[model samples]
Target chain A: MTLQILLNLVIGMVWMLLHDEWNMLTFTIGYLIGMIFIFALRRFFPGRFYGIKIWSIIKLLLLFNIELVKSSLVVIGQITRPKLNIQPGIFKLETKLKSDWEIIMLTNMLALTPGSAVLEIAPKEGIMYIHAMDVAEFKQSIVRTKDLFEEAIIEVMR
Target chain B: MNVSAIIEIIVAVMVLAGTVLSLLSSLGFIRLPDIYTRSHAATKSVTLGILFILLGTFIYFWFMHGLISIRLLLGILFVFLTAPVAGHLVIRSAYRSGVKLSDTSVKDELRDDLKKMKQLEQYHSKEG
Candidate 1:
């Protein structure tokens, strides 16, 4: 839904019309070709960015899906098991990520991964307080999850 | 034996599997203990289930139909973009309104830390 992709879609539709074939197949082909044209003409335009990092978005999405599955499994396992052995706690995490948007994204990532919820964020102070269902090995989870998501997010946003 | 048939099989499998995941998410939603844990069920599993379902649908149109359905792709992005934010908002609002953590929860490090900070603030106010 980025602006550039919207432009690309228009260009693709135009391309289909010009070719005298308005079928889905022709439209798709035109879209890919339009994308290539935009990529090739990037030097001339000097626009801030075309917002066409399709590959990067795909990779980021895959990372998200994998994390979602892994964490969902962990939480479900804890929930449905014979014996409940969870050490639930709320902990303050110091995040190097600055900006309200970045903090919001990070908090959402925390909520979506594992059984952790972002209770509050002190954005100016660069800290987020998170509540987790399983805090038995809290440090390890924090390290592994923060590193994975933070790295991926920085890359994707960049 | 053709490539398209194989692709169709893969797509079918993705769709079926995604449905199963969605089902599990709902099951978890009802079965989880409390609001805090229930939020976990609602957020993680449901979002992922939606992702897989969208992925399957996207591929079905893209590969099988030989037509890139950018709209479906956009729908996937929309879900991905919003799901977590909504989840975070729900939990944040709950905490802000003092929706209690489950009774079985062992520790509340934040509450203790906040109380200590408040005590320190009072002492500093007295000194000043």
Candidate 2:
């Protein structure tokens, strides 16, 4: 990814120098031209263009932030209530993610969202032990959230 | 209030909210039943709190001083990346060392699986 970005930057610079224009507009036009060229010769590249991956990454981050806000509110509500009546427990979840990077990302995202924290992983078993603050209430929601997150993570990692 | 004042107020509000959330996370440490739940409080609430605080600071600098601070942006990103991992590590070690769950815990679905895995490991070792 970094290599692709550097190549694009170099192309943009070369285009600007050729036109003798040292301006943002010149650089942008050069960048777009380089992007098209890269797209045309994409089969020669080892991986997808850096731009597409970056967009997916941004989408994942956005989904993460949205979950963060939503779960934070839920936690705050639980905290401020007059009674502490949460039933926390550890539950087993089967993870569809195969790669270490994807699993790491999913676990971190899960931990940051309220109610669920990854307690342990059985890598060979493809399972995770997740502790949820209110297990009964959160079981279904957690599964839903995990599916959403898994889909987003796969979109980004693939 | 003028536009600049309004922006300042927004920044102040965000910072205040973040501070409150951080305090709530600390309160969770006191009120929560055990290590697992406390870790959840620490990871989620505190992370969101710091994110909010840093983001407000970023916006304040960008809008009020017209200076884009890369440090604040990186701080936000690093906090997001590291906080949960740290929390996870702490809780995992605690569990491995045989910390007992609180009485209020409704179930432990992982326990049987973990035991079965241990038995399998022992059996494999015996065969080898």
Candidate 3:
């Protein structure tokens, strides 16, 4: 991914030099041209083009922000309710993520979203212990969120 | 009325919303049942609140002063990266040190897994 970005930047610079226009617009056009060129010859590269990974990352961030807002609202509601009716608990999450980076990403995302916090990760067993504000309410959604994040992480990583 | 005025209005709204969200998060911290849930409030809403506030500042500087502040952008990024991790670590340590969940808590699923893990560790040590 870094290589692709470096090469694209070099291509953009070269295009600007050729056009004798060192402006933002010229450089952006050059970058787009280089992106397309890179996409076409992506098979020669060791991995996926950086643009796809970048897009996946943006999608992941967008998903996280949306989830954050939704969950924050729910938490606010929970806090302001006349009577607290929460059933908090610790639950085991069996994660499909194998690598340290992906596991860490999932852990962090889980911690912030939808009334959950990570307690511990048993990497050997591929299990994470999550503490949920309302275990019954969040169980199904937690699995769905995990799958959503796992897919997004795989897109960026694999 | 003008573009700069409109931008200032937006910045004001953003900052206000951010402040409200942060206030709600602190409310959550105070009212939540346990350390785990409290950390949730501390991490998620607070991060979003700070993000909104920083973004508002960034936009304000860009439009009002014609200056794009890298510090504001980096501050937003840093909060996004660190808040959840900090919350997670705090909760993890609290749990590891055997903090009890609230009475309202429905279940403790990790206890069985932890017991099995401890037994495995003991078995390994005995063999060694």
Best by DockQ: 2
Q: Let me know the TM-score candidate 3 reaches against the reference structure.
A: 0.93
Kindly report which residue stretches of model 1 are placed more than 4 angstroms away from their true locations once superposed. Answer: A1-62, A82-84, A155-158, B112-128
Clashing pairs in 3: none
- Model 3, position B113, has a per-residue lDDT of 78
Query: What's the TM-score of chain A alone for every prediction?
Result: 0.82, 0.85, 0.92
Separate DockQ for every predicted complex? 0.49, 0.79, 0.78
Query: Comparing candidate 1 with candidate 2, which one achieves the higher lDDT?
Result: 2
Give the runs in model 3 whose Cα sits over 4 Å from its true position.
A1-3, A23-25, A43-46, B125-128
Q: Evaluate chain B of model 2: give its TM-score.
A: 0.93
Q: What lDDT tens digits, residue by residue, belong to model 2 across residues A32-147?
A: 99988887877888888777887888998898999999888888888888899999999999989999999999999999775899999987778999999999989998998899
- Residue-pair clashes per prediction, in order, are 0, 0, 0
User: By the lDDT metric, which is better: model 1 or model 3?
Assistant: 3
**Candidate 3 chain A lDDT trough over 10 residues, lowest sum:** A68-77
Lowest summed-lDDT stretch of 10 residues in model 1 chain B?
Answer: B108-117
Candidates, ranked, lDDT: 2, 3, 1
lDDT, candidate 3, B10-124, per-residue tens: 9999999999999988988889888878888898888889988999999999999999899999998888889888988898788778988889988898888788888999999
Candidate 2, residues B56-76: lDDT per residue as tens digits?
999999998999999998998
- In candidate 1, which residue pairs get closer than 3 Å at backbone N, Cα or C atoms, i.e. clash? none
State each model's CA lDDT, in order.
0.74, 0.90, 0.88
The TM-scores of all predictions, comma-separated, are 0.72, 0.90, 0.93
